[model samples]
Each structure stands twice: as C-alpha cells, then as structure tokens.
Target: MLLFVRTAEAGKYKQSPPDGIEPSTLRLTAARSNQLSYGGTSTFLSIIVQIAQYNLISPLQIPESRILVIGLDDAGKTTLTQRILQHMGQPSKTTIMSTVGLETYEFKDKIAKDKSTYKLFDLGGSGRFRSLWEVYASDATHIIIVIDSTDKGRIFVIRDEIQTMITKIKRANQKILVLANKSDLPNAVTHDKIVNACKFDGVLREFQIRGLNCSALQDTDIEAVVDFVKSK
Candidate 1:
C-alpha cells in the first residue's frame, strides 16, 4: 500500500519522537483510487479488494486476515513482506532469500488498538510454483501481486498471471493489491503504465481499480491494509 502521511503537530506530544509517533493519515490506498492518483516518482502500491460480506468465528474477533502474496521471482515480494513485518512488529529475517516452495508468516499486530492478526502466504513465483497459486488463493482473504516496475519485457507475463489467478480465485470478494516495486529506479514504469500494460481495465472491470506511486520501504501503511481487512 502506497501511504501518504499527514502528521499532526509534534509540539503536542513531548515524550514521543517522530519515529515512535506517527500522526499522519495511514493511507493504504490502491486501484479504484477515487481520491488517489499518481503522485509522480513518490511511492507506488495498488490494492484490489473484491468487497464482500465476511463471516466471523472467534469471540475476540480481531481482524483475522489470510493474505496471499504472489508474483514473479525477484519481483521484490519477499522484500515487501519484510517491510510490512517491520510495521507489524514481527520478527523479520536479517538475511532475506528467495522463498522455496512457500513460506507462511503469522503475526498479530497489537499496535492497531490491540486488534488484527495477519497470516500471509509468501509463495514461490517460478513457473513450477505458479500452479499452486489457486490452491493457496482459494482460502486467502486477500491476494497481493508484486512486480518489478523496470521489467517491461516481462509485463506480458504478468498480465497472463493475473488474469489466470483472477479466474481461479475461489472467493468472489477476495481483494488484490499490486505492489509495483522499484519505482524509485531511474527507468521504472509509472503506476498508470503498469495498469495499462497489465490491461487492468479489462481484467478488473468488477472494481474501480486505481494506482499510486510510492516507495515500498518508506510509504506503506500496513495498518490501513489491516483496517480494510477488518472492514470486510
């Protein structure tokens, strides 16, 4: 999620510093961005949530989410997940490597008023592993696709992957978030180009999908994403 932080006055809080205290809007916005647009070379992330009614079970009823993160190898999926982990206060690996078949990460974010638990599936995106996408997505509440913004040659492959995944997704309201990473690169593609190249208009007609430019490390607000999940 590409977030824009509009902080409040620091003079009000004396004890907490900027790093520990965030006063800005935790904007985790994406496709169907009625109020969002390409903020130039700022930060970029796209969210596609197939809105639907949700069924709750546990009494605590914290925001229970099963997020499926899938994309081509080296698309920065692992890195992006790690960044989100930092926001969630989860223990992250110091040395990140390519995921094997699939890696599962579970964390309960206590920062968002002591609610919300996230279970993320980081699946391998190589050719052989792509087949398992539907298998994992079937039970996932949200699906995230990460793409290397500079790789124009492989954009077609991304289109096919998304289209195929969309058809196989079991839940009609499963949401999707596209992280067009490496946007800060000298020759990276903009949010609009990624959407047009992926033919999102044809594939995501059920949604008012929109895009935004943002940095994965500096601009994401995992809390806003959790808020959306809780809304479902």
Candidate 2:
C-alpha cells in the first residue's frame, strides 16, 4: 500500500491521477508510518474528521505505482524478480515459480532516498493470460515489459504484442521500463535491434519509455533497474 502522511496537508492533486506516472514528476517517496489512536473525554465533545475536501488530497490520496511486470512465460520475468530481490538483500527462499496467471512482488528500491514501494505485477506471459494484461494495465502506474533477448524467432511475437497493447490502452504519459533480459546469452539481440523491432519509436511514441540491457541472473545492469525504479 502506498501511504502518504504529512505534518499538515498541502498541494493539489489532479482531478484524476493517471494509472501510470513518472517518479521524478511527483517527487514521490514513501515514509514509515505507524497507526495510533487516542481518546479524550469531555463534558460535550464530538470528533469529526475531514477525509476529503474538493478532492484536494495534499497531492496524495494517490497511488504511488502499480507496476506491471510483463513478458512471455519464459522471458525471465520471475527470475528477474528474484534476482533483483537477492541484490536488495531480500532473497527468495522458494524457487521461481511459473506464473499460472499472475504473481506480485513488492519492491522498494535501495538506490535512492526515495522510499516508495513499487508493486511489480508479474503477469503470466502465456497466450491465455495475455488478455489479462489489458485488465491490469488500466491500473498500472508503470509497466516493466521484459523481452527475451536471445529468442530471435519469437522476438517478432513479442514485438507484435507490444504494438497491439499500445493501441489498446491510454498510453499518453505511460511510464514504461523495458528490460532486455538474458542479454548475456550467446548471440543475444543488441539493444538497438530490440528497440527497433519493438517499435518503441512508433507505437510506443506517447510513452515515457526507457530501455536497458539486463542479465538478472548474473546481476549485470542491475543498478540501472534499481535506479530507474527509484527515480525521483
């Protein structure tokens, strides 16, 4: 849960916050909070709390992010999650599980002073569950689309899916973090090739997209992942 607490509320939020957002734009960071309750009794006392006033939520009452970690079934989405967690000193005891429908992992990147916890919604890449991507995309604040860099034949499939997805959603200002996983593999596709093939310049034109080469298993390019996620 992305909770925002202030000494005194300030700042105005948009009438409706976008499902996707850029951390730098909000300067969003989480803070450790403890819920406390106290009671006072008087001759005649009544307590009233103002939850909301004209949707003025102190620039909050907003979601930090619901990041959709999407890719093909074997695109290393699960491995990427575990590997990055290990680097963050939160190793997963259970081995990577093949996502049946969806698996969620919450992450608070360690690279920056930013304290928000990003929920990585690892949607199963199977064809059947691909449709669910749209259902979830509507609520996602950021989309981390993982690509299997070594699978040249299916790279087209991945590209087509991306093109299709972009068309089906409200993509303006959508913040996407594209990770080209398994780049350390033999004859892996180059970053340039992946971008062009994925049509990042075309269909994804309206998105605030950033791409990085990553070998999650080997921990290479891991910092880039941490940094971007914790951006702000």
Candidate 3:
C-alpha cells in the first residue's frame, strides 16, 4: 500500500511580557541579576507566570480535526497531500506507494494565541480497497474527493465512487472538498462539465461541498488547495 505522511515542523513561540508587566522592569531586573542566574531563574519564572495567566483566560484547545482524502486511482491524492504539507513548511520525506487501505499524517499549527491540529487520512484509491473505505468513512470530518480534471470520460466513474462512499458513511452533514486535479493541462475538463457529468445537483442539495481547481504538480496551485482545506 502507498502511504504518504507529512508533519509540520514545530514553530518557535515568542513569549511576550505578561499583560500588566512593563518590559522596562523586566529589562532592569535582568540587567541587575548575574547573567547566568538571570538566564535560568528569571526566564523560567516569567514563563511560568505568563503561562498561568494565559491558562486563566484561554479556552481549552480543540481536538484535532480529522479529514479523509479519497478519489479515483491516479487522481493525484497522494501528491496533493504532500503539497498540502509542503505549504505549511513541513515537507515530508515519506513516499507513498499504491495504498491498499489508508495512510495517516498529523499536523499541528499555532496561529497567534490559538493552536490548531489536524489528522489527515490519505485513503487508498484502488478498486480492491473500496470496500474498506466504509469502515473509516464516518471518522472523517471532511472528505476531499480528487478528480482528474483532464479525464473527462471518467467523470461518472468518479461520481459513483464519491456517492458510494457518502452512502456508506451515511453522514449527510460532513463537508466535502472536491479537488479538480490536473488543471494545468490544456485537455483538462472544465469545472462546469465535470460537475454536470457528475450530477452534483443531488450532492449540492443534500451536502455541504465546494469545488476548487488545482494542479498538484505546480507548487503555487497546491497552496490554493491548502487554503481551501484550511478555510473549511
């Protein structure tokens, strides 16, 4: 089975002075104290106090969001997944072979005072693995169904797979992100045609799903896909 894992590198936190504490006071204290002790004691105490204060006002961290990436074979799900990780500055070295079941990756992000985590499952795209998708389908908060935009002839086939997965999961409320991959090619099918062919009206009426054009082969286009995933 081919599985790709991308983990974001941990970011450094710049601890600011506690809300009411003056920077000048901290500087003066540091200046007066011996360099070695000041580095250890003052810094440690300041961090502890700041953390205690932050805890009192901050909300508990939300559990990481779980997402399932699924699509027809050769739809570029693995490549897209790798691109997503890269966009976050966490390029992974894991190479995905043909996935037999599923591959998992964890991502952690700290933006401002809030922390966000995500768990992504890159499910297999082979026909033999279709039966196994149902078992893991319900775990996904969001589903990304990648379609080869250039393979217009197979639109219905992709639609069938998506519908089957949705039916098995039986979660009408789960959000869906339709990635139109291979958009960089001249022969790629237009979004409108693909939607029409896939009979998206039923999905539109029943579920929360949005479509975006992407070319995972190109670095910039992958960023667009990442933004879409983050926005959802």
Candidate 4:
C-alpha cells in the first residue's frame, strides 16, 4: 500500500484528497479522539495543510532490432551500411575507413509504427578480421552480406567465406540479406548469379536468406534493404 500526497491548499477549512487516491483511506487521522476533542464532546477544526501532487508511474519498455553487416574486403560493407542509414533519415559520416573491428549505427523505424530502434553492426570483412565477426554472430537478429558485384574473379573466395560464416549461425529466426552491391558497374554480375555462387540453400539450413541488387555508392535500392529489415 502506498500513500500519495496531492496539491497543497492554504487557509481553507475543508480537507479533501485529490483525484486518483483511494477514498477509503481518506478517513484515517493522525491524532487520537481525546486529543482532538475539547471538554465532553469532540470538537472538529480544519487546519492549513500542504499537499503534494503525486502518482505512481510504470517502467518504460522499448524494442530493438540488430543487423550485422559483413562480407569480403572492399565489398563496400560500410558504404552500404551508411547508405542504408541515410535512407532511413539518419545522419552518418560520409567518409569512413575499412572497419578495423566493428562500427555501429542506430536509427528509429517510423515506417513500422512501433518506434523500434534499428542497430547496425558493421564488422571488418578481411580474412584476419573474420574471427571477430564470429563473436557477434549468435546475437544478431539479421545478417547483411555485401558483395562487390563486379568482382567476378573472387566469386569462389566470397562463396567460401560466406559458407564458413553461415555454418555458425544457429538462431532459427535470424534472417540474411545479401546485397549484390556495385551492380551499376559495367562488369557487375547479376544478383541471382551472386546468390547461386554463395550457395545459401546449402550453407544456411535454419536461416531465411534473400538477395538484392544494389549500388550503395549510387544510393540505389537502399529502400529494399530497409524493407527487408522491417519485415521482421
């Protein structure tokens, strides 16, 4: 049981508890009957009292979504992430280096109508930095694979890296979005070709995977990425 004090009243003789307080407890008094009485019969007298307004407040709760951005070196992972952030109406640094370990950004998803926060984790995609990516794999709600669509010569290398990474993802609800970036380049291959090269059907047994053609440098198809994120 809790007692809440309402607004303070000055000089007035009447006593009343403000709204929201339990009315049953309003009859309780601090002084004994005899002390509050004069002579044989009891005497009632109203006094000045200061009452503060207060009410119980409930704890707040908000939901968050996590997306991990990864792929081969020079695949434009950071560029793609920043482009997505910009598309989401968030301000992101225009120039960024290849992430040595990890980079993060957050934004609100107004389209969802749930006021959900979207967090993107951009991890270095080089061979030496691949170890760091594993540490965060299990915690990600979704994965974004950025591939340089014009780098056809390294298709097998990218496939090997993707296969190795997908093998460790164990979450049933974790989804994957492969962005075939730099698709505007003259030598860029089709997104379907890149998807086939990754062999996601064979590598990912429990996760949902989809591929999209994009040119992050040109700010193209970024909405498709956000749409995929909002799907969850």
Candidate 5:
C-alpha cells in the first residue's frame, strides 16, 4: 500500500540555557512531506510513529551553539574554516579575497545519541570590518582567534584585537580557542611563543584563552578543533 504524510507548523520557541545562563528566542516555521510504502500492518504503524516524531521532537530540540572565528587578514581565518568544513565532509569553494564582511557556515552533528546543530560565523579581519567583530562575538558561545604564526610583526596587532574583543564582551565566562596557524612554515612561531608574545601571561579574570598550533594547509591538528567543539 502507498502512504503519504504531510506536516506543517509555525510558531515561536524559547530555549533556555543551563541555570545561570541567558535564554534565546527562536522562531521556527517548517513544512515537510514524506511518502512511504508499507508491506504489513506492523511496518505501517512504525512509519506513522517516525513521521509523527517531528512535532514531538521540535519542542524539545536543543538550540545550536554559536561559534565565532575572527582574526586579521592573512591570519588564515577562512582557510581554517574551509579546512574544518572539509574535514567534516562538507567542503566548499575557496576564495582568495579576504572576507568583505560576515559569512556563516552551519551544520548538524550527532554526539552520544543526541543531535545538535552548530553555526560558525566568520567575520572579515580587515581594519574596515574589525569594528563589527564584537557585535557577533558577544553572542557566541565560543570564539576562535586565528593567528599567522610566521608573521611575528603582527603580534601586537593580534594581541590588541583579542584584548579588545574581551573588553567588549566583558564576560569572564567566554571560551576562546586561539589557533596559531601556519605551523607548517619553517619560521612559524611555537604555540607557547605565540601565547607569550600575545601577552596572555597577564591575568584574564573570567575570560579564558587556549592556544594551539595548527596548519590549515597541511590539515594538521584539525581534530583539536573538533574536540573543542564537542566538549561544548
């Protein structure tokens, strides 16, 4: 026998973060249809349950965690994003020009039998767009700061940006992942060196920054990024 099921809904949903965290408002509007064939009564009932799962699941759905990646031009921000996506089996087209403004990459993953979506915002690192970085960073659950390990001259510039972002958020709970990129370069600075150069030695009250060596071009240490996200 042939069976066709169609479902549609439009409404507002509010997702509350863990205790002591702020809540977020989300509007969900979706419509879907599924066509299936049933060989027996048992099979038909199972299909019905599967089709009806959407409505039941939507209300209990977990909100996606937002991740922001920011850095100076030529810091390999975009390259790191592209490589991570590619490693996730979602490769995208590469561009040479620096990001003009804001770009987003979103995907879903299942961990420990729970499924959740993630949104990654890649903001342009040029002087013109740097001003807007804080706006996006404020809402992100985690932030990734990419740095050009070989460009020792930009250490101060990079340090200022990171500090400025922290000051803007004014939150001690912010989770920051610093990627000292271009680790494959012979002259690339070590992660420890990058951390020290950035003056991260100072006490950062509530905000936290963790630095890691990565080479986007060589696809090195990409798992560290994945592990960090999963930990969240």
Candidate 6:
C-alpha cells in the first residue's frame, strides 16, 4: 500500500533520487524557489530564475497509494473523494451528477525521497449499480464503504448488501475500510449503535472488515480514513 514513486520535474516523469542528493535537499530547493517567486517583480524574477537554475533541479515529490470509495447512494462517497483530492491540492470541478459506473482520481504526494501516487476509485453507490461493482472490486487494493449514519431505516439493507458483496468477492487479502458517514447530522446514529443495529461486529468477525466513524466534510475526521486506507 505504501507505493514509493520518485519525484521527477515533469508531470508523469518518474525516477529515483540521485545518489548524492537527499530528498530534504530537493524539498528545500523547491521551498526556496517558491519563496522567491511569491512577490512577482522583474528583479526578483531574474534572481529567482538564476537561483533555481543553480540549485533546484526538479519539482517537489512524494510517494502515495490507492483506495476505492464505495457505499449507498447519497452516503457522501463522491463528496469524500473530492475532499481527499482537495486535501492533495488537486481540486476538480464540482458537480452533483451521479456516477454512471466508476470514476477515478489520482493524488500525487511528496514524502521524503519518494513521491507516492494514489488512485482513488469513486464507484457508484446506488443499489441498481451494485452489479457494476464486481468488475472493479477485485482490482481495488483497498476498499472504503461509506454508510449514512443517520439512515436507521436502511440499516438492515446496508448490512446485507455489504455482506453479500464481500461474500461474492471472497478475497482474503482485500482490505476493507468502513466509514459510518454523516456523523455530523443531528439524528446521526452513534457508531456503536450503528454497529449493533447492522450487526457489523459479527460481520466483521466473519468477514474481517475494518470500520470507523468520520465526517468527510471535516478534514481532521477524514484524515483518519485516509491514513487507514494508506496503511495497507
């Protein structure tokens, strides 16, 4: 899950760091260039260009991993996906249309000597689209299943769907990250209450799915979900 990608100057270019140059050195060079470029001026521009020519050889880089986001409709999977993208500085055009089948976004991150890239699969979350999930389910390295924390009426259906889907996949190595989403809602179900109602504890024991409570709109809360997926 911890994919190590080397940072290259150009987009899509990848390579390992040179033997002598540490990643910190490369980051420092980039930071200096950014600082110099902050206040645009002819003199400052020329000086920064000269400094960049001498010290900065490439762009800042880091390593990243992939995760698949899935759940029932209106459970905020798409919103969460966009939030994660924004967190990685790759915000895209916002829209409210339903995902036809599957959508993907790549997040590139800089970490130490390596640049990591995470491919996030934001799959459609409606029951009618469940059939399409199997095609990509096997390909996902990690799975995040988001449940509407306030939807007490649909708990049984949600639980059944999760169990059935995992049963169909039957991949022992596939890591599952469950999100009790919509926690910020006034009537949102408590994490323990949801787990009990859905019998997730029993299902987790049987299927071994990892579950957590989070509000995707909150960056701090969502970070835990990101960390869990990346841990794979």
RMSD to truth, every model: 18.0, 11.9, 16.4, 21.0, 13.5, 14.7
Candidate 5, run of 10 with poorest lDDT = 47-56
- lDDT, model 3, position 151: 82
- The clash number for model 5 is 1
The residue-by-residue lDDT of candidate 4 on 158-200, one tens digit each, is: 7787777667645547788878899889999877887777676
Residue-level lDDT tens digits of model 3 in 72-155: 788888888887776666656466544444556767643222256776767767776666555455655577888889887777
Clashes of 4: 4
**Residue range 1-232, candidate 1, lDDT tens digits:** 2223221222121111234322111111111222212322333322211111122234354236877778898887777777667666778877777765556676777455546677777777888778767766666667777778888898789789878876865554677666677777888897678888788878967643445454554545444544443445
Q: What TM-score, computed on C-alpha atoms, does each candidate reach?
A: 0.66, 0.68, 0.66, 0.69, 0.69, 0.64
Give the local distance difference test score of model 2: 0.62
Candidate 6 versus the native: TM-score?
0.64
Candidate 3 structure lDDT: 0.59
Candidate 6, 121-229: lDDT as tens digits: 7777666666545434554567787888888788777788777776666454667777888888788876677778877777767444776787876643877776665
Residue 145 in candidate 2 has what lDDT? 84
Which sections of candidate 1 miss by over 4 Å? 1-63, 207-210, 217-231
lDDT of 2 at 190: 69
* RMSD from true fold, candidate 2: 11.9
